[model samples]
Target: MIPTPYPLEEALGIGWYITDTPGTGGVLRKSPEDFAVEEIPLQEPSGSGPYLICRLQKRNWEHQHAMKTIASALGISHRRIAWAGTKDKNAVTSQYISIYGVEEAAVEELRIKDIVVRPVGRNQHPLSLGLLEGNRFAITIRDCTAADTAATVAACTAAAAVGFPNYFGLQRFGVVRPVTHLVGRHILQGDYEAAVMTYVALACPDEDEEVRRIRTEYRETLDAKAAIAALPRHLGFERSLLSRLAEAPEDHAGALKNLPPKLLSMFVSAYQSWLFNRVLSMRLADGVGLDDPVSGDRLLFENGREDLVTETNRRLVSVHLSRGRCAIAVFIPGSEGARIEGKSDERMAMILEEDGITAEDFKRAADFVGLRYNGALRPIAVKSEIQSGVLETDVSLAFTLPPGHYATTVCREFMKADPRAMI
Candidate 1:
């Protein structure tokens, strides 16, 4: 349950530090050449290890698509290939992919469309999620004037000194079609039929005209079989879900189960992300300091440690915050071991009360689709290392951010354009 039925648009419209900073209005990801990312490995790979880590550069490839391609070339199942993070489809990105029980020579020989693989080294363990320290981004903002570049540089410099708000970027929910949170809400409420319709029939304006028309037809006719036939082959998720519905219209949960478990879990995570964004917005609106700690706030340090804030410990926490070694943290609500309590607890409770839900509601979601709520603390603001230089008509900016932080969150402050359009 949420106070409001997952307001997708409002959740995305979070605040920024330099609200009036003139934007370097330009296009990002105009081509694969425009945006680039390099994954920063957690540590140097051991020369003698069980896993082969391949450094790959891919152009215009979705994360899962790239995995499947690599898996096919390596003669292994997709699950055998693991990555640190999922890169965007619209960018030219470089990252390390690990394959267990694969030879170094075979990995070096593997090639896939739009992917360049180099055998970097080997590691003793698979590159699990959040294994990377951060990502290095070299993004080009096209068609910008000197003034635009100056504004962007100033924002970046200021952010380097004073951390920026850590709102989850638009991509976390959805960029093209912002309905992941909506579908998640329906599923959490145990309305599987609503979830199916939200995933399959809700046409988004941001999508292409043909896509909108197809979704519109499906919503109007309630004909799953016809809709599945009309949808393009690339829309495999939609096709499979609709095909299930066609066979048994009442089997909503079964239809949803047709999607990959990881992808299905993303819907639940999207909803949690939306709630955090909403609460973050409220806190900003209330004039709370983005990086400053208050009594009852939870303070997290860089050494993977945290302390409860109180009058007795506020001074110690302030010292850490001043040194840029710690930050005030907030929680994404979950059951038992997941939920956090302190200053932010009141805010979380208020939101839960407004939504007519308790923390216990999240526990019930696990009963359907294994949507377990694994909660964690996230900083309200994060420090970034930014280096910007202008070249001809384009402004190139390079920066590194911690794992789980969104680079777009920092860029949006400078660009002030549609975050989705930029990516």
Candidate 2:
């Protein structure tokens, strides 16, 4: 296995590549047109219903920001708009969104630059997160340094067919600042002050110099009003937290609570994702094969059923695995009791213990944030049939991934470049 170049990737528990072949060494999303994503809807929109389902197409827009813009044009709260998954801000993406109590005429009349919302049909219920079948991606990797791009592409594609670590991509944590998990760790530890400060004041070199300067100043001074005045208007989330802090300097919990529940919930979820990645890497480091299950391994079926591999059922589990009936899965710890029977779960438990967190901490976070962290199973590895080609010095890849999987995870294997290049 080849190690990743970026320390951030290593810190995030994405330590090694499954294949040791020389990487294509390229950058992704050099332009908005370089990456394209389209959601595969799980259910088609019904002809008639209360919820207006629209196919939203946008270039270079953050998912939440685009939703809010659409809601503002429709004169409704942003919460009224719902989607299955969040798309990257720097890519050209098309996905389905459900708008509550909005008419087709209103949607048609709405116009936003670099955005298009066309009503597909209606649904009886609003779309919720993870409601999609999957997403199809067409990505181009530009300025590749590979001596034989085709050979590298073929080699990576072959390795991917076997399997690759299904680690959560860097984007799960903020690509620019990557502090969501840090804030989450603070939240789980019941340090609301640290959580708020991390979210508001953490600075990254990738950010604009002015933004980084203000964040650094805020971190040093802890002067909420001064920070708020210095922050640009586009940094509304930071300003909102600072606003709450300015009003009540001691109310860190209150300041955190001021954030939208979805965004707030993501912090904890990012922490869970980070834990999963760590455990998955640990399993690989322990010489465990992802394609096969051993005693104490958890088997996740395509039907969403889970079973444990044991001495008694190891052969049967292997048979099922060969038939593509199930895959080895690791549980992302949450408020709900996650059994610590398997090797991966044991690793997770040890990490949690080292972090000084427990089920009670998760429960408290859920209570404080009004979000449930019911743990879920994720596959330890993913396999996809990649379509690849070389265009001059560039390489293009097309593939589809199930909901909750990150394309960047797959891309990382092909281009072992800096994580920031893929951002």
Candidate 3:
């Protein structure tokens, strides 16, 4: 269970690593050109291999959509195409895609909408999840003056010197609906009806006007047929759920089962990520250092060293701490295996209590199979190398971050405005 970092909004009321630094007013994602991302592959494919490594530069295209397009163009199943990570749909992203049993020539000949496939070479391996060193980003923030640029640079300097909280950004939880965690809670409680209803009917206040109207109708009537008609074609998942309900109506479990298994799994993960954000915020509020270690906190060695904490070997931990080779680890709670110990454990327990859930709740849910969280440790803080340049009202930021860290999290620190407002 690896921690995945994704996007943010200001609705969480979360604390910041450097709370004293107020953000400068800025705009983000004004256009697809505003955010550019390039994935740093874990390793280059060897010359001889069965897989074709393709470097694709896609603009305003989601990963799933791109996969479908590539699969269709190549006349292959979608499962044959693999990528290291999911990139933002509203950005220009360059990533490596490895297709099984495809030749370099065929890959080069392929063309897709808003996507340019550049055959990089071949390797014996297919790109798998987490098979990336990190990501490089070039983000342009508009509506900022020179003074605002200076303030942003100051924030960046502070973050580079002392790391920032690695809270999963608003992207992990849906930016449009923010319902994944809500649905997950119902699944954990063994209430498939509530989960299905929450996903389909509960309208978020932040949603677009037309979407809010349609959701309101569904919420009031619970008429699957009508909802399906009202929903746009882009709302494929919602329509799928509603279609199942229109057929069975009474079998909530069946309706949930109709959803893609990957999506159902994401609901559980989104819930876990939300809880992690809460715990990390609490840790900061409790005066815990993001970089420095406490007696009970776990320290994961990112380098090729043994995983060691300050519990027993304080002297050794101190050495690694100075070198930034290790991180203060926080567990994203699962069924049982990875709970933190001592003082940090108490903080997590309190957080779980607030949510009316315990570690046991993370075990396989009665309604969903294989949706259990096995748990993993995430660092409290993550580092990024940021370079800032200004062109009148628009400010450009370039940086590279390790896997499991969000660029929006870094941007939030500099532009302290509501994340949604910036985007």
| Candidate No. with top lDDT | 2
lDDT of each: 0.76, 0.89, 0.75
Better of 2 and 3 by lDDT: 2
Ranking of all candidate structures by their lDDT, best first: 2, 1, 3
1-423: candidate 2 lDDT, tens digit per residue? 766777889899998788888889989999988999999999998788889999999999977778878888889998788888999989999999999898999999988999999999998999988999999999999999988888889999988787889999998998888889999999999999999989988888899999999999999999999999999987878888899999999999999988777788889999999999898888777767777677888889999998899999988888888788899999888888787787788889999999999999999999988889888889988888899989888999999999999999999899989999998
Show pairs that collide, candidate 3: 7-169, 7-170, 7-171, 8-170
Q: Estimate each model's TM-score.
A: 0.88, 0.97, 0.87
Number of colliding residue pairs in model 1: 0
Candidate 2: where are CA atoms >4 Å away? none
State the lDDT of candidate 1 residue by residue for 393-418, as single tens digits: 67777889888888777776666565
Which has the higher lDDT value, candidate number 1 or candidate number 2?
A: 2
Model 1, global lDDT: 0.76
lDDT of 3 at 27: 80
* Per-residue lDDT value at 224 in model 1: 93
lDDT of 3 by residue, 386-408 (tens): 78877777778888998768888
